[model samples]
Structures are given as C-alpha cells and as structure tokens.
Target: MRFATYEHRDQHHVAVVDEDGTLRPLSGVHSLTGLLTEAGSVPELLDAATRMLDAQPGPHVSEVRLLPPLQPPTVRDFVTFEEHVEGVRRSVDGAAGVPERWYAAPTFYFTNPYAMHGPHDDIPMPPGSSVLDFELEVAAVVGRAGRDLTPRQARDHIVGYTVFNDWTARDLQSAEMRVGLGPCKGKDTATTLGPYLVTADELEKYRDKDGFLRLGLTASVNGEVVGEDLLSNMSWTFEEMVAYASRGTVVRPGDVLGSGTCGNGGCLAELWGVRGRQDPAPLKPGDTVTLSVEGIGSVSNTVVPGADPVPVPIARRRTRERP
Candidate 1:
C-alpha cells in the first residue's frame, strides 16, 4: 500500500492511497513518524488505517499539499555501487579504482536528517558553490528496530521505499574528500525525498527470480534526460547496507538508509566517465530535476537562486611531504 503525509483542514495528516488514487486518512495520526513508531506490520497498519478511513471523508491527492513522508530520525547514506565509487575516485583524484577496504564491507556516512524537502519543493541552489549536481538513488525506511543484524535478519526490517535525490555541491565535495573527510558542506544543502512511500509488498512483482528488486532508475533535468541506470546494478544491496549500519549499533524504526549513487547515473560520473570530464553544465537556477524509480513514484524539484553565497574553503596542498 502507498502512504503519504498531506495537508488537510489546516493540519497535516498521514493517509493511505487508494487504488484509484484517493486518500484514506488515519483520523488521529498526524505524521509518518506516528505511524512508523508503532512498529506494526503492513497489513496490521492497513487494517487500522481502514478503520480510520471510515470515520472521515477522503480527499484527492491533488487537493492537498504533500510533505516528506517522514523527517528521518537519522540518515545513513551508503556508497555501495562499485562503479560509482571508482568513477568518483577517478574524477576527484585520478585514482583508477576503488579501495580494497571498500569491498570488505558496505560502508556509509551520516548526513543531515533535517535537510529534507518534499517531492515538488523548490530548493535554493546551495550557496558558495557554483558546481551543483544530482545523485539518483533509492532510500529504504527502516520499520523494525534491531542491533547487529545480518543481511538475512535485516530484510524484514525495511518497511518501504522511496525515490531519493542526493542533491550535491560537486565543487565542495571534490575539495573536501581529498582531506580524508567529507561530502559534508558539499552535500549539506538539500536532499529531496518522496512523491509517496510504497510499502515492500507493493513492489513484489518487480522482484527478480533471485528475490532482488530490479527497479529501473532514471533522472532528467529540465525535461532532458541526463542519466539512466538500474537498481539491479547496485553491488551492495540495501539489505547489506542496512545490516552493516547496525553493526553493534541500534537502528530504529524511523532511520533512513540510501543506496548511494548509481553507476554513471550522477552528474559527477557522467561528466567524468561519459562526458570526458568536460563541463556537462551543472544544475543552475530555474532547472528542474526529476527522478523516478519503477516501483516507488517520482519526485521533482526546481533550483532557484540563493540569498547568500557560501564560500568553499579549499585546503592548500602541502608541498613535498609534511608531518
């Protein structure tokens, strides 16, 4: 079943989407957090939602304002696609390949949980950097809490999926990562999520014979197609990333984990690997970026001018070698 948080009667409400595209709102639940906090299975949540539905008249999705499904309790974005990692290393430092340790385990970094936007919001082009880009990816929302989970055990913890746009400031990222840290100021700007949240069972048909979700991932800018890839190409599945994230630490119901960027499916990789490192012309004011994943719906955002410019602090290279 699909779910959304929409505005109605001057208040936000959590609702389930009907087959014909109307909403069946839960009477008392006001946010996605309230719904996920219960840790109930999909069917149980649906049953309860159905009861609430009968108490209120439904509204069409077009009549309401949708918000990010949930303000993530925490967010961990994983760099799991080998080709994406290799391409980035090549672009940023002219490295030919991924590190050996990268293959040893699924690795991830924590990003701003509060830097979120809805499907159709217009985000200000992050200040400071002129080089801006988009990363098309899938985000899995954790439903059940666990610690030290294995891939086998983590599978059931994922409750739903959504389209994720890891909007980036490429110039800042390139400089920061060289100091052995960051994607921070580069990525801290904005991350767009949602058109709607699709529960795991809703995507069962997209599952391959091997039980992997083989959704097609694509992104376009200003109605022009830029990158296209498949979720099937990810080397580290979302489950592996989820489990790895739980290594000795607890993962709660509202946490979010991203599948990183797809192969040649981000502007950085596309510019370097496919476009010969030429300027593909990063996103600018008035440009629209739309991202779609097969099972989950699509999310689109527009870039506009920022009020202030953010300065990039590029660290100077040390001459020869300094201790």
Candidate 2:
C-alpha cells in the first residue's frame, strides 16, 4: 500500500493512494507525530495504519504533496557504492588510494533531520554553490529498536523504503571536508525524500533470487537523464548497515538509513567525471532534478541559484616592528 502526507483545503493530513488514483484522507488515523510516537517496538501501528487506508479508499494516482513518510528519531546515511567512491577519489588529487576495508564495511554519517524536504519541493541552492548535484538512493526506515543485532535480525527491523535525493554542493564539500569536520556545511543544506512509502512486503517481490534488492534507480535533470543504475550494485547491504548502526546503540523505528549514491547512478562526477579536470557537467540554476527508484516512487525538485553573496577572503596588513 502507498502512504503519504499531504495538505488539502488548508489542513495537512495523512492519506493513502487509492486504486483509482485519488487522495483518500485517513481521518483520525493519527498524524505523523502520533504515528512516530510508538516507533521501535515493532508495534501494530503500521498494520493498523494500512487498515485505515483500506477503509477509506480514493484514486490510484492524483496530485498531492508527498512529505517524508515518517518522522525519524534519527537520520543516518551510508556510503556503500564503490563506483561513487572511486569517482570521488579520481576527482581529488592524491586521494586515489581507497582503503580495502571501505569495500567491506558499511560506513555511514548522521545527517541533520531538519534539512529534509518533501517531494515536489523546491531545493534552495546554497550560497556560492555553482556546482550543485543530486544523489539517488534508497532509504530504509527502521521498524524495531535493538542493540548489537545480527545481520539476519536487522532485516526484520525494516518497515519500508523510499527514494532519497542527497542534494550536494560539491565546491563547499571539497573545502569543508578538508578540515575533517565530517561534511558539515557541504552536506547540511537539503535532502529530498518521498513521493510515497512502500512497505517491506510490497518490496519483497523486487528482491532477487540472490537476496539482493533489485530496484531500478534513475536521476534526471530537466527531463534529461543524468544517472541510471540498480540497487543491486550496492557494495554493502541495508541489513549490514542497520546491524552496524545498531551496534551498542538503540535503533528506533522510523530511523532513516540512506544507501548512499548508487554506482554511476547519480551525480555528474560519477556519470561524467568532475569539472575542469574531467569536463563533467555540473548542475546550474533553473534545473529540475528527479530521482526515481522503481517500486518505491519518484521525487522531483527544482534547483535555483543561490542569491546570497559569496564569502570574501580577508587581506591581512603586516605591521613593521620598531627596531
């Protein structure tokens, strides 16, 4: 079943997309806040929520604002795509030596929840970011909380999946990460999520016989395809990521774990290499980027140039000491 949060007639409400493409509101079915109140215990809330949709049905597909499916207690994103890593490595000078361990273990970062935006939302370009880019990823929503869970156990903790666009400012990232501050200013700008949340059951069929998710992912700018790939290309699995994240820490339900950019699947650097050094195409103002993951949904966002002034380096005057 497809679930979404939208605003109709001045009030924001949760609704289920019906078979006929209409938005059927789920009244008294609990707001996003109330739904998240019971995260992590593997509560019957999602089942109950799905039943509510069955009760009041609407169209199959209609125009509506798709908000982030859940209010995550925490949001963490992982870098599990070797192609993206290699592409980034090739971009930077003397960074070609990627540790072999990076290919084995799932690495992740906690992102700011405040930066999340809904589908069809406008992503404001950061100031001085002439090189804005988009990343296509599949984010898993945690359904149960536990510590030190094994990889097998981690699979049971997932409730659903959604398409995620990790918007980026390449120039800012390059400068900030040099200080080893963990992608502060470069990554804190905005992240696009949703269109709809597809339950784990719905996605089960998409999993291949090899036990890997086989969702097709694609990203386009202004209707022109920029990046395309499959979820199966990921070097690390979501279960591994969850198990790693849950190590010695409680991973509550609704917590979002992003599967970083797909292999050659998103971003110009991965698709066409980096600027100047490689003649890659970077995003500019007035470009619309859309990230679509099959079986989940698609999120479309427009990018505009930052209107703020660029920071200027201060010139220091040397004072002569009296002899």
Candidate 3:
C-alpha cells in the first residue's frame, strides 16, 4: 500500500493509495508520522489502514495537492554510490578518485528536516548561491524504533520507501568543505520528498536475488532527461545504511535515511565532471527539476530566485603581546 499526506480544505489528511491510484482517506489521521509511530508495527498499521479503506472513498491523488508524506524526526543522507563519489570528486573538486576511507563504510550527513518541501513545490534558490543542483535518490522511512541494530534487523524497521531530492548549492558546498567541516549552508536550503510513500512489501517483486532493488531512477530538468540509472547499482544497501545509522544510537519511526545520489549523471556536478564544465549550466529561476523512481513515483520542484545574502562581519586575526 502506498501512503500520502495531502491538503484538503486547508487541513492535512493522511490517505492510502488504492490499486487504481485513488486515495482512501484514513479519517481522523492527519499525518503519516502519527499513523506510523502510533501503530505497534507495520502489520498493525496495515490492518488499520485496511479498515479505513472499508469505510468510504476519498479524493483522487491528482485532485489534492500532495505534501511530504511525513515530517521526519531526522534526515540522514548517505553517500552509497561509488560512481557518484568518483564523478563528484573529479568534476567539482578536480580530484581523481574516490577517497580510500569512503570504501570502508557508508558515510552520511544530517540535513534540516524543517526545510523539506513537497512534490511539485517551488524550490527557492539558496541565499547567495548561483549553482543550484538536484540529486536523484531513494529514501527509507523507519517504522519502528531500535538501537544498536544489525543489518538484518534494520530491514524490519523500514516500513516504506520514497523518492528524495537533495537540493544543493555547488559553490557554497565547495567553500564550506574547504574549511573541512560542513555542507551545511550549501545543503540546508531545500530537500524535496514525496508523491507517495510506497510500502516495502509493494517493492518485493522488484528486489533481486542479491537483495538489491532493481528499480529505475531518473532526473529530468525542464522536461529534458539529464540523469538515469538503476537503483540496483548502489554500493551499500538501505539495510546497511540504516544499520550503520543505528550504531550506538536510536532510530525512531518517521526518521528518514537517504540512499544518496545515483550513478551515471545523477546530478549536474557529475555531468560537469564528464564535460569539463557546466555544460547544461546551473539551475536558474524558471527551471524545473523532476526526479522519479520506479515503484515509488516522482517529486518535481521548480527553481525560484531567492533573497540576497545578508553580509557578515569578517573575523580578524589578533596577535598576543606580553600577556
């Protein structure tokens, strides 16, 4: 079953997607976080949703505006695609290859959950940034709480999947990383999620013997396809990323784990790596970016100009004398 949150009569409503693609309103439920976290488990939530479906019909998905399925408690994005890492290093930083430590384990960074946008929402260009870009990836929504979980255990905690767009400011990211710290200001702008949260069982048919999801992922800019790849190409599985996330910490329901960017031109930075320059150019006002994942659906956002940055006073070096 696919789940979604939509605005109806100015109030948020949670709905389940029917086979025909219509939404079945789970009356009284306002958000996916409440529904997902309140339930004892995924099976119990499904049972409740099934009962709701038996009650009455709801609105068609096309009619109601969709929002981010849930307001995640935490959003951790991992760099699990080797090809993406390689391309980014070569193009953005003019480096040759992936870092040796990158192969040791999956690494992730936390982004602002408050900054999330829904599918079809307009994305504002981050302040003081000119090189806006989009990343095509998948995200898993944790349905159960757990601590110190193993990879196998992590699988059961994931209730569903969704498409995630990690919006980025290339120039700002470059400058920040130079200080050896963050992608903070560069990435905290906007992260798009939605269309639907597809239940894990719905994707079993697409899973391969190797445990990889063989779904297709694509990103298009202003109606032209810019990037494409298979979800199966990921170096680290979602289970692995989740397991790593739960190490010595707790992962709660509604927490999101992103699969990072896919390979083969997943983002504009990768295209610049192959072309030696920004061939397609950076995203500007009026451009739209659409990222789609097979079985999960798509999330699209249009670029809009943002306010100019408010200048900050520069710090000055001081010399100590006869202290």
Q: Pick the candidate with the highest lDDT.
A: 3
lDDT of 1: 0.81
lDDT for each residue of candidate 3 in 1-323, tens digit (9 for 90 to 100) = 89988997787889998878788888778778878888736687898788766377778888888899989999999999999999888877899889999999999999999998999889999999999989999999999999999999988998999999999999999888988886879998899999888888889899998888999999999999999999999988888888999999999999999999998879999989878889789999999999999998988899998888989978877786675
Better of 1 and 2 by lDDT: 1
Residue 78, candidate 1: C-alpha displacement in angstroms: 0.8
Which lDDT tens digits does candidate 2 get at residues 23-130? 776767546535644543233655666556545554334555566765667889998888888777666433664669797679888887888888888888887677
Which residue pairs overlap in candidate 2's backbone? Answer: 20-59, 20-60, 21-59, 21-60, 21-61, 22-59, 22-60
**Candidate 2 error regions (>4 Å):** 36-46, 54-61, 92-94, 272-280, 307-323
TM-score for candidate 1, residues paired by index: 0.91
Compute the lDDT of residue 188 as modeled in candidate 2. 77
- Model 2 steric clash total: 7
Off-target runs (Cα >4 Å) in candidate 1 are: 309-323
Clashes of 1: 2
